[model samples]
Target chain A: MKSAQRTTRRPLALAVAALVGLPLALSACGTSTAASSSEAVTEISVMDYYNNEPDKSFIGDALTKCGTQAGVTIKRETVPGKSLISKVLQQSSSKTLPDVLMLDNPDLQQIAATGALAPLSDFKISTDNFAEGVLSAGTYKDKVYGLAPTVNTIALFYNKDILDKAGVTPPTTWDELKAAAAKLTAGEQYGLAFNANPTYEGTWQFLPVMWSNGGDEKKIDTKETEQALQLWTDLVKSGSVSSSALNWTQADVKDQFMAGKAAMMVNGPWQIPALDKQPTLQYGVVKIPVREAGQTSVAPLGGEVWTVPQTGNKARQAKAAEVIACLNSDENQMSMAKVRNTIPSKTTLAEKFAAENPKLATFTELIKTARARTGELGADWPAQATKIYTAIQTALTGNASPADALKQAQGQ
Target chain B: MSLTTDLSQTAAPSSGKASRKHGRPAGPPTEAQAPRRRTRQRRERIFQWLFLVPAVVYMALFFGYPVVKNVVMSFQDYTTATFFTGEAPWVGLANYVTVLSSSLFSTSLLNTALFTIGSILGQFVIGLALAIFFQRKFPLNGILRSLLLLPWLLPLIVSSAVWRWILDKDSGALNRFLGDLGVINTGVPWLTSTSLALIAVVGVNIWIGIPFNLTILYGGLQEIPDELYEAGSLDGATGWKAFRHITWPMLRPVVSVVLVLGVVYTLKVLDIILGLTNGGPANSTQTIATQSYDLSFHEFKFGEGAALGNVLVIISLVFAVLYLRASRRAVDE
Candidate 1:
C-alpha cells in the first residue's frame, strides 16, 4: 500500500512541478530569443496609434518607404488612440520597447520626461526647418526627442448653404461670431456646436477661443479667460448653441453639423474626408474667430510625432532615427499632408501645400500661428488642461458663473 | 466481524481499550500495526486534500496576487514614470488622504450610492413583477420568457451605444416618439443636462439589469413547489396573502442572493456608464468606479486610484458579509 501511494504522490508532485516550471521556462526562452535578436536587428519594430483607415494606410506606406531608405524591414504595430501610451509604458517597464514609437505631440513631453526616448541629436538627426509649435511639442528639457511631419489645428467649419440662406458671413471676431450664430439659430437646429465635455478635447477646443482672447493658460483666473468662458456660457444661454454641447465629442459635433442640426462647428481638418463623403454638404473652413480684429487665432497644434525610443539596441535605434528623418523629409511630408488632410509642419512647404490644396488654405494659414499645448507647461499640461475643461463644464452647465467657475477650477 | 468493528479496533486504540475496560469484545493493537494504520489514514487525508489543490492555486494566482499588489500600490507613489523606472517611493497613507479629501470625492460617493441603490431597486421590483406575471400558464409562455433575455445577451457597450443614439436630445427616437405623441414642445436633454444625466444613466442601467434579475428570480420561483400555494388557498390565503406568506418566505434566500450580487455588480459598473455618458455634463454621473479609472488612466495616478478602488472593495465586502449572515439566519429559521 505504501509503495502504491508513493507512486501516485510522485506523479502528482511531478505534475505540480511542471505546472510551476512552464511559465518560467517560457519566459526564459522569450528573453533569450529577444537578446539574441537584438544583437543584429535587420528589422526594427515601429508602433503608432493610427489604428483607423486612410491615415493608417498612409502612415504604413510612409513607414515602409522610410524603412527602405534606412535599409531595414519595418515591423509596424498600431494600437487604438487611447491605449498607445499605456502600451508604451508597459513596454517600457518590460525593457522591450519598440525601436520606433509615435506619440501625439502633447504626449511627447510626458513620455520623454520618463527617460524612455533617445534624443534625435544622439543619432545625428537634423531638427531644422520644423514649425516652432511642433518642435516645442516634441522637445523636453531643451532636447529634441521627436519630430512631426504634418500638423493640424481646429478651425471654424461652417455649412455654406445655411450661412448663405441666413445671409450671414463666416465670423471673424468674437462679437461677429456671437451675432452670426444668434442670427443663424432657427427651428430644430442650433447656430453652432462645439464640444465642452469634461475632457481634454473640450480643453483643446476652448484653447483657440481662450488664447485668441488673450487668456493665458498660466493664469487662468484672469479676466481674459473669464471673457472666453463667458462667450461659451452666453452662447448656451442665448440658445444659439445646444446645451448638449456639454456632451458632444468633436465627432458628435460633426455628425450634428452634417445632420443640419448645427450650422457651424469648431473642428479640425481631419473631418474633411467625412465631409466630402456627403456631396451635398457644402462647407467652408476659416480660422477660429479672434477676440478682436487684430488678435491672432492661436489654435492648439494637433499632430503625432515619431521618435526613437531608448530600447538599448544601438543598431535598431540608428535605423529608427533614419526612418524618422525620412518620414519628416519635405517630399514625404507634402505627400502625407495631402493624404491626411493636414498641413506640413515645415513652414517652407506651406505655400506649395496651400496652392496644391486650395480648400485647406485657411488651415495652412492657421498652422503658422498655431500653439503647442505643452509649449508652456511641458509635462504639467495635463493638469492645466483638466482645470480648463472643468471650468468649461461648470460654466456651460450653468452650475456657476464664468468668473466663479474659473476661480473654482483654478483653485483645483 | 464487520468493517466498522475492524476499523475501530485498528484506528481507535484508546477507545478500544476503554471498551475492554467496560468488558466489551476488543482486539488489542500491536505497535507496528498502529503506526501502519496511522500512515494509511494520513495518506487518505492527503488524497482528499489533493482534489482542492487546483482551486486553491487558481484563487491564489488570480485573486490573492492582485489584491496584495493593489494594497501595496496604494501605499506608494505609482505613476507613469514608475512603470519605466520601477521606483515607487513609499508615500504611506498620502494616496488615501488625497483621494478621500479631494473635492470630487463626496460627489463621486453620492453618485455611486445613488446609482447602485437606484439600479438595484428598479431592477428587483420590475424583475419580481415580471417573474410573477410569467408564472401563469399563458400561451407561448416559454418562448416569451426566453425572448425576455435578449437584452442581457447583448454586450453592455453595444447596448450603451444604441441607447446613446436613442436618447439623443434632438434626433433621438425617444424624443421623436414623444414629440409625435405631443408630450412636449422641445426635445428633452436626456444625457446632456446635469439634472437629467444621472437619471438617464440609471434608466439605461436598469434596462440592462432587468433581464438578469428576472432570470434568477424566475428560477427561484420555479423551485417553490405548488402544493404550498394550493394549501394556502385552502386556508383562504390567495393572491397577495399567498405571496406574502408562502412565496416571500421561501424566496428569501434567492432574493438575498440576487440583491447582494446585484449590488456588487452595480458598484463596479464602469463600462456602461463610460460608454453612455463618460461621467460628463459637469460630472453629474461620475461614480466612484469611473473616477477611479479616470485617476489611473487619465491622470496616471495609479496609487490614488488603487486607494479609491480599495474603498469600493471594502464597501462590497461589507455587503457580502451581511449577505452571508442573512442567508445563514434564513437557513436556521
Candidate 2:
C-alpha cells in the first residue's frame, strides 16, 4: 500500500513542478534583449506642438497623408502649447528622440546650447525662402535647427464701440496712449487691458517703447526702457487700466473687451477669432502703434521650426528630411495656411496665403516688425517672466516704485 | 535530562494511553505519545508562521527594499533618463546641496508647513466637537453621522475643481453673490491673487479631512467607559468642563493618530494645489510635491526629482519614529 501511494504521488509532484517551471522558463525566454538591424529602416518619431484639437487634426491629417505617399511611415506625437520646450527637453532625454520636432523659436538657442538636437545645415531645402528675420530668430550657433513655419507678430485688438465712446483713435505714441487711456478712464470703463502677469506679452509690450526711444534690451537698459515701464505702471496705478489687468490673462482681456469693459488691448491676430466669437461686440484689428517717430512697429517675432530628431536609420532620416522639404514647398504652406489660419513662412507664399485668406494679411505685417525674445530663460521662462507683471503689480498696488521694481527685475 | 525522561516516559506509555485514548486495543509498533501533543506543536508552528509571513513579505517588498534603494539613489546623481543610459554619475551630496539651496525647496517647505498646521488643527478641533455632539442617542443621529462623511467621500479633485468654479472671478457664485450683496466692489481674484490662492487650496483640503476625523473620533468616544463620565457628573463636572476633564484625556490617543496622519498627508499635498492653481501667480502656492513634479516633468531633471522624493521619505520616516515613540509611551502609561 505504501509503495503504491508513493508511486501515485511521484507523478503528481513531477507534473506540478513541470507546470511551474514551464511558465517561468517561457517568460525568461520571451524577455530576451533583441537588437535591431542597422540596415533596417530605423523608425523616426516626430513631435508637433499643435495642442489645440483643430490644429492637431490639421497637422495630423497633412503629415499622415504625406507620410503615406512617401512609402515610409512616420510616428508622431503632439504636445500642449503651454509647455512645449519643457516637454521636448524631457522627451529628448529618452535618447529615442523624434527625428523631427516643433520647438518654440526662442528655445532653439537653449536647445542648441544643450547639443541635444541636430542642426539643419545638412538638410536640402531653400532655407532662404524662409521669411526674413525668421532665420535670425531660429538661428543659433550659426546653424539652423528649425524651418520657419510662420511669421507671427503683435497687433492691437480694440473694441470699436469702446473706442468710439471714448472718441479716441488707437494711440500711436507714448504720450497719445497715456492721454487716450486717461480720457477712456471713466466709471469702470478702462482704456486698455494688459497683464502684469509676465508673459511673452509683457516682453512684447515692453520692447516697443524701448525701440521707439532708440534702445534695445541687448544693448542697454536705457531711459526708454525705464520710461516705457513707467508709462504702463502709471496707467495701471492711475486706474485708467485696471491694475487687476496686470493679473488677468490675455484671454481675460479678450473677454473684458467683448463685454465692453476694456476699450483697447495690445494683442495679436490670435484674438481675432476670439473677438469674432463675441456676437455683441464690434472690434477692429490694426498694427501695433508706433512708439516714436520713425520707430518701426514691433511685436516679438513669433514662429516655429520643423527639424529632424536625432534617432533613426540613415534611410528613414533621409526620408524625414524629404518630408520637411515637402512641407517647405508652396503647396504645403498654402495648405497649412488654408487649414490652420497661419501665415506662410516664405515671403512669396506669405502673400499667396494672405491673398487666399484676408485675415492672414494682418499677421504678415506684424511678422515683418517682429523681434524674438532671448531663450536663456528655459523652462523657468514663465516664472521669470511673471516677475515683469509682478513688478507692475507692485507699482500699481502701491507696494513699490516702478523704477525699483524694474531694477529688481534686471537682477532677477 | 528533560528530553530523555520525557521520551522514556512516552516510550513506556506504549501500553497505557494509546489503549485508553484510542480505545481500540491496537498493537503499538514503536512508541506511544501524548495524542494532543503533536497537534499542539504543529498548531503553534503554523500560527507563528502565519503571523510572520504577511509582515515579512510586506516589509521586504514595500518597506525594506525601498528604503535601501532610496538611500542608495540619494548618493548618486541620477534622473529617469539615467535608467536607460545605464550607470549614473556619482554626485555625492551635490544634489542634496542644490535641493537645500533652491528657492523651490524653501518655498515649498514653508507652504507645506502652513498647510499642515492649519489643516491638522482645524480637522482635529472640528472632528472632536462633532464626535461629542453625535455621542448622544439623538434624532437622525445615525443619518447625521453618515451625512457628515460626504465631504470625505467626495474625491479631492472633485472638491478642488468645484471650489475653483465657486471662486472664479466673473462667473463664480461666490464673487457674483458677494458683489450683488455689495459686500465687495468687484470679482475677487481668489485664485489669481498670490496671497489668497494657497488659503483657498488649504480650506478645501481641510474640508475633505473632517469626515475621517469625525468617524474615527466618534468611534473612539463611544468606547470610553460610561462610569467614568457618570462619576464625573456625580462630582458636579458638566458640559465643556466635563469634556475637558474627562473626554479629552481619554480621546488623546485617537487624536494623536489623526493629527499625525493629517500632518503627513497635508505636508505632501500636491493634487489639491495643482488642480486648483498650479502654483501660479509667480509660484506663490508652489509646494514640495508640485516642485518634484515640475523638476521631473518640466525640468526633466530626474536626479533632482529623486532627491526631492527622498526628502519626503526622510520626513515621513521622522514622523514614523515620533509616532512609534508616542504610541509606546501611551501604551506604557
Off by over 4 Å in 1: A1-39, B1-30, B33-49, B330-333
lDDT of each: 0.88, 0.67
Cα error, candidate 2, residue A13 (Å): 35
| Pairs of residues at least 3 apart in sequence or in different chains that clash in candidate 1 | none
Per residue, candidate 1 scores C-alpha lDDT tens digits across A293-406 of 988888899999999988777777888998999999999999999999999999999999999999889998988888999999988787788889989998888899999999
Lowest summed lDDT window (length 10), candidate 1 chain B: B1-10
lDDT of 1 by residue, B1-333 (tens): 243244434655554454467665666665645666677667754765586578656754566556766887899999888876778999999999999999989999999999999999999999999999999998999999889898899998999999998998888899999999999789899998889999999999999999999999999999999999999999999999999999999899999989998999999999998888889788899999999998888877899999999999999999999889878876786
Please provide, for model 2 over A1-412, each residue's C-alpha lDDT reduced to its tens digit, 9 standing for 90 to 100.
4444554465446544544444444423322232334575535567878878777887787777667666667788887776776666555555556667777676666565556555677666568776656776666667776776555666667777778876889777777878887888776577887665534455555555555565555423346666766787778767677755544566767777777777887766656666666678877766656656567766666767777655534566677777777777778877876666566777777666667777667777656556666533433344444455445554555555767765655554
The best candidate by DockQ is 1
**What does the TM-score come to for chain B in model 1?**
0.90
